[model samples]
Structure formats: structure tokens, C-alpha cells
Target: MDIRIGMLGFGFMGKTHAYAVENLKYFYKNLPFTARITALCTAHKDTSCAACAEYGFDRACGSEDEIISDPDIDAVDVCTPNIFHYETVKKILRAKKHVMCEKPLAVTYEEAAELARLADEAGVTTQIVFNNRYMAPVLRAKQLIDSGRLGDIIGFRSAYLHNSCMDPNKPAGWKQTGEYGGGVLRDLGSHAIDLVYYLCGDFERVSGKSLIYYRERAGMDGAVWKTTADEAFYITAQLKSGAIGTIEANKLTVGVNDDLSIFVHGTRGSLRFSLMDPNFLEFYDGSLPGGDYGGDRGVTRIECVNRYPEPGGVFPGVKAPVGWLRGHVGNMYNFCSAVYEGRQAAPSFFDGARISAVIDAAERSDRADGAFVAVAQP
Candidate 1:
């Protein structure tokens, strides 16, 4: 099977997805299908045309409709702005095409829910780009949690922070504007919320607070403008399984760069992971017997590294250190494989909608002066 993707948007995520598709075979041996980006669609025609020629795409499309309606396109890979997701995804599903959408599925829960429903009715393979879940250490953490090593998860704290938004003089992009759904909450909070929800259970209730440390900043056009979105978000949530934790996403952190870390505590053990230390997982076993010499009571660093499953691990070797991009590759492989096998992918639109619902609830909570809000069911 040849899984040809129609790539929308020629930005950061576009390049990332393209790299993932182009390099899948090298990392995963004995792939069941050949996956490639066959068409390119961008905000500008010239750039799209140039991308097609440079990246070996067969065609350059002026609009998303061209790619969505293309007979040769097996899937629509959405890497466009947050504001474009709902409509683009609806059209792709209406066309009966598979979709690989980036995170925070839609700007609102209603839109996300409708997309999830449409995907289900279409019976098309779908995946949301919660790429962090593909990290080896993160996967290992899931394995341990499922195995009951961290018996009955009770609490967790996770945060994703960056310092890029701290400088008021820096020109802002679409992400810093409210109209395009730009904000740290939806940008980074979506990941943090998903990470916790993936390990913990469904959210029961949440209280959230948003802050805008820098009220004024240069807009995309370099004009001084008032900030319309949050620079940081703090959330306190209760899970359906009776666990409670704090989740945060902040861009005003003075000295942070792609820093995402999580600490999960349970009845029997605890697990810690940091994106800064991509190769290992820190685990502490409360079940370890106490001794006068403190025998085996300390945290053990498990070297998860690039230890992907068969068809992977071989390229970089299991012992090799994997970086952030490895997760994207793994995520792409999973989606493509599911499509080829005619199976629904994990982290599907359902997962995306659920996360978006939590986000919506959190925003409402922020507006209500940090009052608790219930996450709506999909």
C-alpha cells in the first residue's frame, strides 16, 4: 500500500511531519506500506510551489480543498494554524479521507466533538499529534503504570514551559493572538493536560487561572499591540479515578527551553520524567523493603533511550539517546501503520476531543475566577 499524504501548511510542523514521513522506513524495518507526502498546500502559492519542487511533491495546491478532493491523496496531514483545524478537518472527513491532525484538535470542544463524530461515521483512520506520548521514556512510564508497578496512581504534576514569550519587544506570531487560538494554554497546556490524562484517568473537575505577564507586545506586523492571550496557565484538576494534581503551561518562565516534566505518584511507587533528560526515566519503588543500610530505596534511572519496538530501535540502536524528534517519527509511524492496516489509530479524534473539552473547561474556569468546572463528555 502506498499511503500518500496531502500536507497542508509549510511551517514548522509541516517540515516535521515531512521529515517523519521521509525517514519512517529508515527507522522502522519491514513497513507494510510506503508512506510519502505527495502534495503540498501552504498559505502562499509561491511557497507551496517551491515546497513541491524542493521536497519532491507531485503537486502544489492553492487551497486545502484541492488536497482534500485529490483522488491520489490517501490522507490529509494537517499542520496548519489552530484556527484552521475545525474547517479543514471537517472537509477532509467529508471527503472520506484519513487525517493526521496536530494537537488541540480544535479551538472549541464543540468543533472537536463534531470532528470526532464525523471521523467515526466516516470510518477513517485518524490520529491526533500528541507526539510526547511516543517518547520511549514516556512509553516506558505507561508500561510501568499499566503493569501496576506504580500501583493505583494517586496524583501527578506536570508542566511545559518556554521563555519565548517573555520578551515584549519580540514580534508575535499567530500563536500569540487570540483570533488564531494562540496561547500557552492551548499550545503547551494541551500537551501537559494530555500527558496527565494519558497516565491518569478522565478529568472530573478543574480550576484554572491564566496570567499575562507581558500585556503589550509587538504584533506579527511589528506594531505595538495589547496581548490577547495568556502567557501562562495554572490548573488544578481531579481525575475520575479520585486522583488530584496540578498542571501548568507557561511561556514567561525566565530560563526555560522546551522544558516539559512530569511527576506521578501512586500507592506503590512513583515515576518521574523530564524532556530535558530524554534518555531516562526516574522511578522510585515504595514497595522496596526498608533496611538499616537503606537498601534499594533510592530512585533508579531506567535507560529507556531509543528503545523502540521491532522495526525501530535497529536504526539508532536501542542504547542510543533519542531526542524530541524521535517522538514525532514514532507518532507518524503509528498513524501510517494504522491507516495501512485499516485500523483506528491510538490518540484518535476521541482523545483529541477529550483533551479539548478539558481545555474548554479550564478556560471557563479561568473566566469564572478559578471556580471548578466539569469536563464535558465526548
Candidate 2:
């Protein structure tokens, strides 16, 4: 089967998705379906045309409507801004086409939930871009946790930090403003929250605090502008299993580049993973014997570099170091395979909605001055 895709937006993530789709054949052997971006759509026709010519897309479209209405497009890949996701996804779902959406499904939980509903009604394969979940080490962590190696998750700490917001002189993009539904929590926190939720469990309640250290920054146009989004967000959440954890998402931290780390502790064992050090997962087997010299009780670093199962790990030889882009490739492969196999994707629209619920609860807690807010069940 050829899964012809109509892609919306051509920004960083859009290019990333294109790379993943174009490279899937090299990463996964014997892929059941071939997928490609058949059409490209952007806010401007000229930009879209240029991207199509440069990136080998079949055609360029001026608006999303053309892509959504095209019968030849079997799937729609949405890499647009946070603000446009809700409406664009709604149309694609209505068209009964498969969808692959980026993180924080929508600006609000209500919108995310609505998209989830439409996705279900459409009966089309859907996936949310929680790319971190597809990493080799992260996947290994999930396996251990599911096998009860982590026992009952007692606590966890996850954080995604960047240095983008540290300099006040830097020009603010759409991500630093509420007008485009951009906030550190929604941008980075969603990934952190999803990681914990994916490894640990569903959140029961949460308390959150937001910080905007630099209230003013230069806008994209070089004019002085007041920031309306949180530069940093902190959340204390309890899972339904009674495990409590803290999640931090900030862009103001200095000297960090795409640093996302997570530690989960349980009664039987513990797990640690850092995006900066993506090739290995640190695991402590509590069941191991402990001698006077600490014996085998110490943490063991499991090398998970490109160690994906059969069909995968074939091109890269499984020993090659895995990087951030590998996760995107894995995510795209999963979505395409699920669509081909007539199955639901793992991180489906429902997962996106659930994560949005957690974000919604955290935001409400922030508004209430860090009071505990119950996460709405999706």
C-alpha cells in the first residue's frame, strides 16, 4: 500500500517529519507499506511551492483545505503551530483520513478531547507526536516498567529544559506568546508529562506554578514586546497509583540544549533516562544482592542504541548511536505501520487528549496559585 500524505506546514518539525517519511525505507526493512508526502501546504503558496520543489513533494497548496479535500491523500500530517492544530485536525478527521499530529494536541483539553472524539468516529489511524516515547532507551524503560521490574512506581522526576528564554534580548517567536497558544508547559511540559504518564500511569491530581522572569522581550519584528506565556512551569502530580512526582519544563535554564531527563523509583527497582545521553538506560534492580561492597546493587547501564526489534536495527546495524531524529523516524514508522495493518496507533489521539487533560489541570492549578487540581479523565 502507498500511503500518500498531505502535509501541513513546513517549519522545523515539518521538515523533520518529511525526513522521517523519506528515510523510513532505510531504517525499517520489509516495510509493509510505502509512504510519502504527496502534497505540501503552507500559509503561503510561494513558500509551499519552494518547499515542494526542494523537498520533492508532488505539489504545493496554498491552504489546508486543498489538502484535506484531496481524495488522493490517504493521510494528513499536521506540523502547524499549536493554535492551528484543533481546526486543521478536525477537518482531516471529518474527511476520514489518517492523521499524525504534533504534541499538546490542542491549546485546551476541551479541544483535544473533541479531536479525539472525531478521530474515533472517523475510524482512521491517528498518532500524536510524542516522539520521545519511541526512543530505544525510553522503549526499554517502558518494557522494564511493564514487566514489573520497576515494581509499584513510588515516585518520578522528569524535566525538559532549554536556554532559549534566558536572554531577554532574543526575539520572541510565536512560541513565547499566548496568541499562538505557545507556553513552555505546552511546548516542553507536554513531553515531560507524557513521558511520566507513559512510563508511570495516569495522573490523578496536580499542582502547578508558572514563572515569567523576563516580562518583556524583543518581538519577531524587533520591537519591544511583553511576554504573555510562561518561560518556566513546575508541576507536582500524583498518579492514580498513588505515586507522586515533579515535572519541570523551562526554557530559561542556561547551558542546556534539549535536556530531557527522567527518573522513576519503585518498590522493586528504579529507572533513569536522559535525552542528552540517549543511547543507554540506567536501571537498578532492587532484587539484586547487596553485599558490604555494594555488590550487584548498583545501577546497570543498558545499551539500547538502535536496538530496535527485527525489521528495525537492520539499516543502522543496531550498534550505531541513536539520536533525537531516530525517535521521529520510529514514530513515523509506527504510524504508517499501524495504518497499513488496520490497527490503532499506540500514542493515539486519545493519548494526546489525556496528556492535554494533564496540561489543563496543571494550568488550572497555576491559575489557582498551585492548588491541587484533579486531572479530568478523558
Candidate 3:
């Protein structure tokens, strides 16, 4: 099978997705289908054409409509901004094409729920880009939890932090504006939320607080502008299983670069993972007997670097230190494999909608002065 993709937007994420598609063969051995970006579209025709020429796409589309209407394109990859997701993904579903979308599904829960409904009705393979879930350590974490290694998750604390918002002189892009559905909650919080949901379970209630440290910042054109988005967000949530946890997503932290970390404590054992230390997953098994000198009782570092199951871990060797890009590659590969096998992808639109619901509840809680709000089910 040959899966020709029509990719929307040519920004940083666009380039990342393209790299994932182009490098799939090298990372995964014996792929059942070949996939490539056949058509590219962006906000500007010139930029699209230039990207096509430079990246070897077959054609440059004047608009997303051209990509959606094309007959040869089997799937549409939505790498556009958060504000564009609802409309663009709706059209892709209407066209009966498979879709791979970036995080946070949409700006609002209503839109995300509708998208989830449409995706289910369309009966086409769809995937949300929760790339962190594809990391070997994350995958291992899921396995251990599923195997009851961590019995009855009691609590968890997760954080995704960055230093981009620390400087007041920095220009405010779409990410700092409310017009584009940009905020720390939607940008970094979505990943943190999804990981907890994936590992722990469904959320029951949440209390949230949003902070905007820099009310004003330089605009894209170097003009003074008021920041309309939250620079940091904090959430205290309770899962349906009675497990409670705290999630913190912020861009204002000092001396941090993609410092996403999570600690889950359960009755039997606990799990810890950090993006900065991506090569290993720390696991503490309480079931082990403890004696003097801490006999076989402590955190065990499981080397997960590039140690993917069969078909993967073929290229770059299994011992190679896994980087951030590897997660994207694995995510892309999973989506392609699902499409090739005529199966629903993991982290589907429903999962995205669920996460959207959690974010919606968090935002509501924030508006109510950090009052607890129930997470609505889609």
C-alpha cells in the first residue's frame, strides 16, 4: 500500500512530520506501506511552492481546500495552528480521509467533541499527535502499569516546563495570543494531561489556576502588545479510580528546556520518568523484600533507549540514545501502520476529545477562582 499524504502548514511541526515520514524506513524495518508527503500547503502559496521544491513534495497547493479535494491523497496531516484544527479536520473527515492531527484537538470542548463524533461516523483511521506516548520509556511505563506493577495508582505529579516566557523582551507570537488558541495549558499542558490519562485513567474533577506573569510583550512586528494567553497553568485533578494528582504546565520557569517529568505512586510500586533523562525509566517495586543495605529495593533504571519491539530498533541500533525526534518518528509509524492494517489508531480523536474535556474543565476551574469542576465526558 502507498499512502500519499497532503500536509497542511510548513512550520516547525510541519518539518518535523515530514522528517518522520521520510525517515520511517530507516527506523522501522519491513514497513507494509510506503508513505510520503505528496502535496504541501501553507498560508502563502510562495512558501508552499518553495517548501515543495526544497523538500521534494510533488506539488504545492494554494490552500488547504486543494489538498482536501485532491483524489490521490489518502490521508491529510493537520500541522496547522490550534485555531485552524476544528475547521480543517472537519473537512478532512467529511472527505473520508484519514487524519493525523497535532495536540489539543481544538480550542473548545464543543468543537473537539464534534470532531470526535465526525471521526467516529467517518470510520476512517485517525490519530492525534501525542508523540510522548510513543517514547520507549513511556511505552514501558504503560506496560508496567497494565501488568499491575503499580497497583491501584494512588497519586501522580506531572510537569511540563520551559523558559521561553521568562524574557519580557521576547516577541509574542501566536502562542502568546488568545486569538490563535495559544497558551501554556493548550501547548504544553495537553501532553501532560494526555500522559496522565493514558497511564492513570479518566479524570473525575479538577481545580485549576492560570497565571499571566507578563501582561505585555513585544509583538511579532516589534510593537508593544498585551499578552492575552496564560503563561502558566496549574491543575489538581482526581481520577475516576480515586487517584489524585497535580499537573503543572508553564513556560515561565527559569533554566528549563522541555523539562517534562512525572511521578506516579501506587500501593505496590511507583514509576518515574523525565524527558530530560529520556534514556531510562525509573521503577520502584515495593513487592521486593527489603533488608539491610537496601537489598534489591530501590529505584531500578530500565534502559529504554531505542529498544523498540521487533520491526523497530533495527536502525541506529537499540542502544542509541533516543532523542526528541524519535518520538515523532514512532508516532508517525504507528499512524501509518494503523492505516495500512485497516485498524483504528491509538490516541484517536476520542482520546483527543477526552483530553479537550479535561482542559475545558481546567479552564472553567481557573475562571471560577480555582474551584473544582467536573470533567465532562464526550
lDDT (10s digit) by residue, model 1, range 1-378? 999999999899999999889889989988899998889999999999999888888889898999999898999999999999999999999999999999889999999999999999999999999999999999999999999999998999999999989889999988888999889999999999999989887999999999998899998888999999999999999999999999999999988899999999999999999998989999999999878999779899999978898978777777557665668779999999999999999998999999999999999999999999999985
TM-score of each: 0.85, 0.85, 0.85
- Write one digit per residue (lDDT tens) for candidate 2, span 1-378: 999999999999999999999999989999999999999998899999999999889999988999999999999999999999999999999899999999889999999999999998999999999999989999999999999998999999999999999988888888998899999999999999999999999999999999999999998787899999999999999999999999999999999999999999999999999999989999999999999888778899999988899888786776568665668779999999999999999988999999999999999999999999999984
Which 10 consecutive residues of model 3 have the lowest summed lDDT?
317-326
Once superposed on the true structure, which residue ranges of model 3 sit more than 4 Å away at CA?
323-378
RMSD of each: 19.7, 19.7, 19.7
Evaluate all candidate structures by whole-model CA lDDT and list the values in order.
0.93, 0.94, 0.94
How are the candidates ranked when ordered by lDDT, highest leading? 3, 2, 1
Span of 10 residues, lowest total lDDT, candidate 2? 317-326
List ranges where model 1 is wrong by over 4 Å.
323-378
Question: In candidate 3, how many clashes are counted?
Answer: 0
